[model samples]
Target: MWTINRFPGLWLLPALLPVILMTVYPIGHALWTSLHEVMILFPGEPFVGLRNYGRVVASNYFQDALRNSLVFTLFAAPSVVILGTLIALFLQRRFFGSHVVRSIVLLPWVLPGAISAVLWVWVFHPSFGILNGIMRDLGLIEDSILWLTNPRTALMAVTFAHVWTQIPFAVVLMMAALSTINSETLEAAAIDCRNPLKRFRYIIFPEIKAMIVVLLVYNALIAFTSYDLVYAMTGGGPGTATTLLSFQIWRESFSMYDFGAGSAVAFIVVVISAALIVAITRALPSDLFAGD
Candidate 1:
């Protein structure tokens, strides 16, 4: 009788085949395409080696898009984890209307990204929007803020929208992690540590640290590649102020018909994202995954 370990590769082939066909094949095709000049301006899709990559790298528009993506990730990722964890802690307790509150928390994330963008666009609208009207009623400011139009505020506005949708997912994940904490362990910690902060520091903090790290990395990846929200909300407008790498790739490939250059940019984005995931995985405490 042959053991399962003797035929590990054979057993895994069925599962791995679909992944290779779906992911690896497409990536290989893109890399091959990126090596040529496939735009309308060029006939026959002549081989250009790394010229497409060079063009993409040299373009000022691409640089601006990269900067905007980085800025969005910086603001949105941390906000998602912090706000999510805080809200999760609040909702995890048994209190009056807690179920309703948890349901309400999921509303933003459940809505489609484009829908959320459209909803927020109205909320942030300059004239007669709820946000502006409320601020005015409170005598906060006389003038309405251009939340999505002005270059100064456009990226941050989108970040706010992205974070709103991300928080619910964080809450869901962190809540699950919180549920795994043993009640007896927490009770013992409470007895030894009178202060709430110390109890949380010695007990709750250690248990939830891994979840928080995972949430941060997950949120960062989403923010880095976010496209639909930006498209529906700002259209990467106010003159490329919010044109992230995803939108930039869309513009290059579909709008300008620069398939080769777009593929080069996309491959670069993939490389960066992969590197970030690896870094995040490496940063996890060794003991965090010891059981697995």
Candidate 2:
């Protein structure tokens, strides 16, 4: 007699085995490594007991990298969400060549991050760059700006490039959410809500609110952990202007050959990212996860 109790629970082990090996083991290994003094050039891995963490916290580079990461997330995440929603709204309308336009919009997102960064590097070049040429034609400036080289503009340039790559993803998700909205409800609301802004506030927004929150959290996490763009474009340069924590980890581990410090930084990033995700999820509407 097949009953609920008779069901083979051990059958699920195969599915769970991969997750344990991939996620659980790596995190445990990293945590263990962070507690020891392990250097590539050194002969021994000694028990340091949080010394690496203390050094990482006290370092000026760590402070700069942390601040830069937060600043980049602040700028890049919201820009991706807002621009994505706006573009999604435009594409929602049926018009000639709309399909073509939608395909074109996804080109940036389809390209590899390193490739996108390289393209942006050329675009932001001080001389013979399209951006500068456009600005010059518009009479915006006579002198060429060092976009990636200048400390002030370097972070902004990287953020812009990140935003461009992320927006297409946001648009696709938003459009999916928007498609679920009832057209009759929108039409009914249009009677009293003649203004498009009012219609969105009253009807469209409430429908897509959950997706918006999802996009915010997803994009924020991506921006916080971003590495490829910074590595390819600026190499965290102009003196640490664009160095995020992810880049800091790479530099500490490979560049400086301090595996202990890099592991500590990596663990810090994991903790903070997990906390941020949890906090945002809790603070938003409780019904966000509710099923229709």
Candidate 3:
């Protein structure tokens, strides 16, 4: 018989090895690369000691990309979480064809990111797009809005698309959270508090508060690191309007052949993601993690 003390973590090596190789090794390599002058055209990878990081930070591109990323995360994360919660609540009601509606709602989540990007591109196309047509019919606008092309609206357009793709996941998680609410408590609240808003505020909100925090953090991270949608939709914009850190990494590494700068940007992204997640968790109520 295999004793626990005799072979500590031996059995776990098989599982842990792959994770170490995949995550640990890449991060280590990126960190190593970031400390050097790793231009692909250069003959040698001379040690630079944070020069790549300094250069990336000093660049206007990095500042613009950072601003855009923050804005995207701010808008997309809350929109996904709030819209998802509301939709999940509406779906909880027993109505005709509710099952079908639930399935349809998950369609966006199931679709590939590239495909979703393509679909949204057509939806937001400047000329002869569905959105423009609808707005025109409603007398909302005299001319089609330049969504992907114009710098002013490009970031918001991408954020809207990201929110759309993310909402199905948020809804699923919120639905599961909502399912855990005690029916008796809900019914009692409904009787005593006829106001729907009051019921949500006092009862429903408390029950799903933990899940809300989780969804917010998760969605924020997704928005912060999102690349495929931006790449496929706007290709980092008419200018640098929609350029995010992830895209910046790609631009430096592949487009500009500056591997050291790319790795530095990648490291910055990792640090930012970690810090944002920590800040969000710390700012929220401690009771979020309380055991029943």
- Residues 36-129, candidate 3, lDDT per residue (tens digit)? 9999788899999989999999999999999999999989988999999999999999999999999999999999989999999999987878
Question: lDDT for every model?
Answer: 0.89, 0.93, 0.93
lDDT of model 2, residue 81: 95
Lowest summed lDDT across 10 adjacent residues in model 3 is found at 283-292
Q: What is the lDDT of residue 147 in candidate 1?
A: 81
What lDDT tens digits, residue by residue, belong to model 2 across residues 1-292?
A: 4754587876787998999999999989899999999998998999999999999999999999999999999899889999999999999999999999999999998999999998999999999889999999999999999999999999999999999999999999999999999888866887877899988886898889889998999998999999999999999999999999999999999999999999999999999899879987888878765764
Off by over 4 Å in 1: 1-5, 40-43, 281-292
Candidate with the larger lDDT of 1 and 3: 3
The estimated TM-scores of all candidates read 0.92, 0.93, 0.94
Model 2, stretches more than 4 Å misplaced?
1-12, 282-292
After best superposition, candidate 3 residue 15: deviation in angstroms?
4.2
What TM-score would candidate 3 get against the native?
0.94
- lDDT per residue (tens digit) for residues 29-54 in model 1: 88988998888766788899999999
RMSD per model, one decimal? 2.1, 2.0, 1.8
How far does residue 143 in candidate 3 sit from its true spot (Å)?
1.9
